[model samples]
Target: MKHKTPLLDQLESGPWPSFVSDIKREAEARAKNEKGVDFQIPVEVCEDILGVMELTYEQKRTHWKHGGIVGVFGYGGGVIGRYCDQPDLFPGVAHFHTMRVNQPGGKYYNTDFLRKLCDLWDKRGSGLTNMHGSTGDIILLGTYTHQLEEVFYELTHDFNQDLGGSGSNLRTPADCLGMSRCEYACFDTMALCYDLTNEYQDFLHRPAFPYKFKFKFDGCPNCCVASIARSDMSFIGTWRDDIKIDQEAVKAYVAGEIPPNAGAFKGRDWGAFDINAEVIDLCPTKCMAWDGKKLSIYTPECVRCMHCINVMPKA
Candidate 1:
């Protein structure tokens, strides 16, 4: 049966990308497949998912009913229990649960690995996934209670992977792609992340802590991973010594020969670069000064905030 979702359909008309559109597309595909071809999830499940969501929109409240503590055997965390309140109307989504699969270090994966993972989820899950959730895990969106163990086994045995932490356990540790791509990296963020995850597998796989914990690693002060703001334990790399200055590059920036902020603002017409206003003035510690041609930095007062180095990479 075609599910009428007028309220949810309104979300598809705007300029922004809508998840409603994606779900509708999946629902349509599943509906057309008469022979139940492929490992695609049932069309009723997709339709019921839309039905439940539309009900919530119409009622201005959630229709999800939290189930009791539930997870796969031998693992206390990773699986989250969710049940729809209107089970009779949406039985296909009645036991909808979520599984958090631990992503590879730095999220590196080959095509074979990804295809196998998708195939596994398609066979056992609702076929919805978050590429990488906030905690840096692959979120497998909807499955039944009975299929949890089989899904976990296939993940571990077939895919050679495990689940990420949830509940009171240590959440998945995430790190920026450090030495692999970033030149500013002072340490091996991915290596450290891998090592720590293995060292604390017990804590990561079970609810051993009173409160939820997290670890995030950033190779340099740039903190592309937002380690400082989000993680309970943050590892931010920084150089303790003085920053080496390149006089020729500094002159190049001053002469408008080089773009500021490593050419990040190249598209915008920000006019000429100003050393005193852009670099020195923006320095949090106020330890830098530019004397016409030369840039001076007091070593002791420097907090190594990286603003100067980021602005003048050559210097």
Candidate 2:
């Protein structure tokens, strides 16, 4: 009995046109040689054999990996490429590179910048992008060893502005859509994110921590960015006081004969929490009252939370 040649053995032969076709041919030949031509091997045989062959090929390709940093020029060039040269040691990694591009607040990029980035990726990268890695930098993938520095230089245009990601320093800072778009925004999240990035360029490039750190900002309580779940440091805006009630507004509401639940105080469930009447009853001004038709809140004893205010905004 002779040992069967593996399906991939042919791909290792001089330059093969298509590994898949080569495997198919090998499979046919194996069937013929085994006197099992009439017997149908499971379709899964092809899949399993091809998978194993591809894995083997990939293992050979990754035997030596090459890696280095490349940066896009201006506005802080992004970090690109982590390729390895030694196949015996690092292999298939040469086929893939990782590049980081800085994303502005709200992940907005000007048309010129976007075009330049796309052109660069098409010319040199794997033509794939992660569009914001874990650190919030746009991640470009795939490149070769020889193309690393050239791609880096081309992307950075000679290190003019600054790059956004890499090393031990702080990654890109992400911010929510601030005052420009959100009505509840109280601060300029965009300006703050940019300021932090510019002020800490050194920190962004140098690895100087036991672990990586991330900073994120939310314009309001809605927290659209999921900052609280992932960021080490996060800032979210929230109102500290309760809703304000105007007595005149309440009178107008009453005169208008609007439902007690109408207006800014509508659809509120004040009873969601157990109210302590002992605390309300001890009110220095007997301001808390439930009159079946409406709750009365003496402005003097009203500490906010809009409990009574929601029940009777005209209070």
Which of the numbered candidates is closest to the native, going by highest lDDT?
1
- TM-scores for all candidates: the values are 0.93, 0.53
Q: Rate the local accuracy (lDDT) of all candidates.
A: 0.87, 0.55
RMSD of each: 2.0, 14.1
Tens digit of per-residue lDDT, candidate 1, span 11-63: 99999999988877766766675546564335477789999998898899998
Instruction: List, residue by residue over 129-227, the lDDT tens digit for candidate 2.
Output: 567787777776555545556656765573232446565557778888788787657577888888887887766766566666778888765566767
Each model's total of backbone clashes: 0, 41
* Root-mean-square deviation of candidate 1: 2.0
Q: Give the TM-score of candidate 2.
A: 0.53
Candidate 2 has an lDDT of 0.55
